[model samples]
Target: MSVTRVELAGRSYEVRVGSGLLEDVAVQCGPLLRKQAVPIITDANVAAYWQEAVTGSLTAAGFEPHFLVLDPGEATKSWQVLEQVVDWLLDQEVERGDHILALGGGVIGDLTGFAAAILKRGCGFIQLPTTLLAQVDSSVGGKTAINTRAGKNLVGAFHQPSLVLADLDALATLPSREMGAGYAEVIKYGILGDHAFFAWCEENGAKVVAGDAAAQEYAVDQSVAAKARIVAQDERETTGTRALLNLGHTFGHALEAETGFSDRLLHGEAVALGMVLAARFSARKGYISQDDAARICAAIGNALLTTEIASLDLSCRGADLVAHMLHDKKMDAGTLPFILLRGIGEAFVDKHVDLAEVGAFLDEELAR
Candidate 1:
């Protein structure tokens, strides 16, 4: 087991990553097991694979496990579900001193965390992320939110988890397509700031995707560590440092909105394609060379992710994509700051972006 510490302004938490972590979750979280019965929120899909082990572990520890399982999908991250979770937690009589366990993928984590954030003015929560995307990215940085009609993650809070348990064994049940989407976020760490890690991914990304234990642990550790360092410095995103973490989020979120936030485009898939678009757009702006742009796409392709926007078959035009982007949470002073790359492993937030120019770029991309 490998543990990484995420230090924030007034508090810190450990992100525990390894195999069999779920089976021993009770022991790992024993100190925080304040009540005899622990309340957890999960999606049905994850419960099918992991609920038994998790419940068994807690049972062995003399802790009763209560579960509120929702239907599995991005659609669950809505205001409707958020209310249901909060109401259920209240019915369970969850107190602020109690920590709720979020035991599923990104959707579960985001909804549960957001619920905890607003429940009784804020409560503690633990993240038991099952998907690679959640384990590496969403589960860590304390950023939690539910999607709104406006855009993705527009309504949320920066509520850090009391603890994060990323059980690598959970990946064994993930379909290949899901694993590929998760790899997009793993590669983001490299593309944004760590060139060496990106190179390492080029050589070993396939191994991680294939369920190689060592590779999985290393990638999770590295990705979580990178996010920890950044979150520690800018917990509230007061500085531009934390925004760099949204390397491909701007374009990805637009794609998500265009697709109705459905399974048509998984979040990680959108991010993978978004990174490619960010790189290509950077090249268009003369920030990076064509070769570097090609390199980014090549790496994404190698990870078995879609690199072309044309493949999604969206009926929307570039103007439509830009329209969705106008709802992005990153907009500042009516200007959307885009994270662009100067080269491989070098990403910076550019606030000088012109929406009309971005729309023109998207128009050209759609043509190809």
Candidate 2:
């Protein structure tokens, strides 16, 4: 068991990650929920896997439990889903002070957090992250969002969770592919800043992917601690620190968008490939050695991601992909700053990057 605290201006909370935390949820979250009308919002997939134990805990504690279950996927992270969740909250009579439980992966957390943020102008919420991705990244940060026709996470808020319940037991139900996707984000913490942790991932990521308890706890604890520290200093992403977290995402999101945000490309896989390309591109820019880039790709392969992106012969060109990045939510003043790296453990935001150069590089990768 490992616990890390994320402190912000008015809202600060602890991210408790470990096995059997779900059973202790009521005890741990009692003060956080404040005994109000708390609603548990999940998707159909997670509901099938975790609905019983979660509702059982709430029911045992003598609190009324209402559920809002969405169809799971990036497609569900839309304005339509937002409307449906808001209606469910209205039916439950959820208030500004009440808590909404986001009980799935990133998609569920983002939609539910946005709902809580806008419900009567900001309701409280708790995070019950069931997937590794949610447990480490989405569940802790105040960054909540819904995707749009323009791009992913185009509409959202910065409403933080009152309590984040990261139960490793919930991960037992994850599909192996889904686990790999989430692991991509787990590796991201190391790539962005922490060299020692990056080395640890190279060594123990296999243990985590195999669902080892201690490795799972450490991955969640360290990842959350890294993100919490960044969020604390720059909650709204005022500085470029939070943007570094998007390391591989800009290119990955474009791949997702081109595929119409379907199962053909999961978020984590996109990040996995995107990070590979980012490293490759950095090597092309002479910032990092090709050997360093190869090591990054080797680490990604050890996690079992299909990094034969070179062999994919993707239907889209680098120029086409660059166009998709234009829709990125983080773009500013007509220039899209990229999160590039000089080496494995060092990531930086480069604002003046020329898109044509990025397009040429993508074109080369796609051809390979």
Best by TM-score: 1
TM-score of 2: 0.97
Taken over the whole model, the C-alpha lDDT of each candidate is: 0.93, 0.86
Distance from true location, Cα of 155 in model 1, Å? 0.6
lDDT (10s digit) by residue, model 2, range 110-226: 999999999999999989899999988988888899989989998899999988889888888898888889999999989889889999999998788887878887888888899
What tens-digit string does per-residue lDDT give for candidate 1 at 1-368? 88999987677999999889999999988898799989999999999999999999999999999999999999999999999999999999999999999999999999999999999999999999999999999999889999998989999998999999999999999999899999999999999999999999989998888888889989999999998898888888889899998999999999999999999999999999999999999999999999989988998898789998889987878999999989988888898999999888889999999888999999888889
User: Each model's TM-score?
Assistant: 0.99, 0.97
Steric collisions counted per model: 0, 0
For candidate 1, what is the lDDT?
A: 0.93
- Model 2: lDDT equals 0.86
Clashing pairs in 2: none
lDDT for 145 (candidate 2): 93
